[model samples]
Target: MRIIRLSVGLLMLAMVGTGCISKKKYDALSKDHETLRASSASANSNLQTCQQNLAAATTRVSSLEEQIAQGKAAITALQASLEKCLSGANQGNVNISKLVDEITASNKYIQHLVNTKNKSDSLNMVLTNNLTRSLSREELSGVDVQVLKGVVYVSLADNMLYKSGSYEISDKAGATLAKIAKIIMDYKDYDVLIEGNTDNVPISKPNIRNNWDLSTLRASSVVQALQNQYGVDPKRLTAGGRGEYNPVADNNTEDGKNKNRRTQIIITPKLDQFMELIGQAPKTDGTTPQQ
Candidate 1:
């Protein structure tokens, strides 16, 4: 009986010890599970925050790209405006300079005309008064001719040159042209200007139309005769048409209107500086052909 009781007590003690070990194992397993859950939650939270921040950053980057595009467009427009302004400013500058130069040139011309008027008047009178005494010819019968302001003026009337309005040079007028050409060719000092003038007589035809046409044709005819027949070099000649713009006499009077319908040959001397400059050339021996 004593041995049986001892065996029973040892068995009881073994059962209690096993129960304590099982409870300790259960507590450790529960703690390990909680730790794993906490770590997983923290990792998931961090990943979600990073995604949200990345989305915000991406949106900001996209907005910046749009702003950059707009800025570039604005810059392009500004550049175009600047270029236009520059071009306009440059044109204005050039025009102002040209106007200044023209003003200066006109002043010089006016001064020169004022100073030479008296001496030129004395020489010009000998050639102007009494056309019969100075120039005599049948072709110049009704044609009025005079020398004024250093130019020869040939005024045509209906009785002279042609039947009504024609560009034909008359038979006797050939001698007059020859005489004029001889005088001009004789002196190599002057440059000549042949200007054709016309009356206010309106004309319209297949061959001729208006004063401009008549004047141009007459001028051309005179130029051709001078160059071909008179042996005048073309380089030394220039012809122009006034077309009733410049008139020496009243147009209401028949005789005065006749004087307005005219041609003129103006002779002029080049400035001395031009000749001096040309003479400075080493290849030329101070002699240049006037033509």
Candidate 2:
């Protein structure tokens, strides 16, 4: 029995003695596993950074697109405005571009006759008010002939003719009227509006009563001169009279009153293009003009 126990103990001792493992090989395997885990962590961090950069780049691209859209819109608006302006000027010598560009939605405004307005701006700058035989007192008075707000405000005074109550465009006024007539004849293709006005003084004549009648007659007479004498286009001509209502200055002063009583010959160019810019159609002859 002792011999059998001794044999079993010997066998256990030999198994324990032979159970040897290499420390260097186990440590190498452990190091390889740690390196693999670190590499995986680094790769994940790089992927997160790449996603963040992509998001930032997308935002920048979107901003640039917005700016491009705004610029296109601005360019479109300006082009439309410029086209409309040119059209209005082409219609008449009385261009009111400044008025159109300047006047706001606020109520302060003057009357705008549609047919007359379209014709007021377009001109070739012909007959630069030089000859003594055909110019108004204002034109001869070192006047600067320039367009303002698109209206060719012809500055003239009634003192060139008439003795405060007369409608006869005096013999002295002939030289001035002749030059103007020549200009009108030269631009026969244009439209014309002869407007007459009078001071605040009450005018009650046997034939002409009130300032309205006097103003109307004066305007009519001017129209007749243009149409009959110079052979201006009657279709392009119109006469309107404003007694004391359409004053440009204070009637309390003599100079102011004179300024208000003067006549205006408005010349207009073609207006088809101008009307289109404003989303309207140019009024052809035989149709009632805008007022």
Please name the candidate that would achieve the greatest lDDT relative to the true structure: 1
Task: Single out the weakest 10-residue window by summed lDDT for candidate 1.
Answer: 282-291
For candidate 2, write residues 157-236 as lDDT tens digits.
67674555778776666666666777767765556777788889998678788899888888887788777877777887
| Candidate 1 lDDT over residue span 99-186, tens digit each | 7766665555545555454545554554444333445666456556666556555554533443357777766567677766776675
The segments of candidate 2 whose C-alpha lies over 4 angstroms from its true place after superposition are: 1-139, 142-146, 271-291
TM-score of 1: 0.45
Residue 289 of model 2 has an lDDT of 27
lDDT of each: 0.67, 0.64
TM-score of each: 0.45, 0.48
Error of 2 at 271 (Å): 4.5
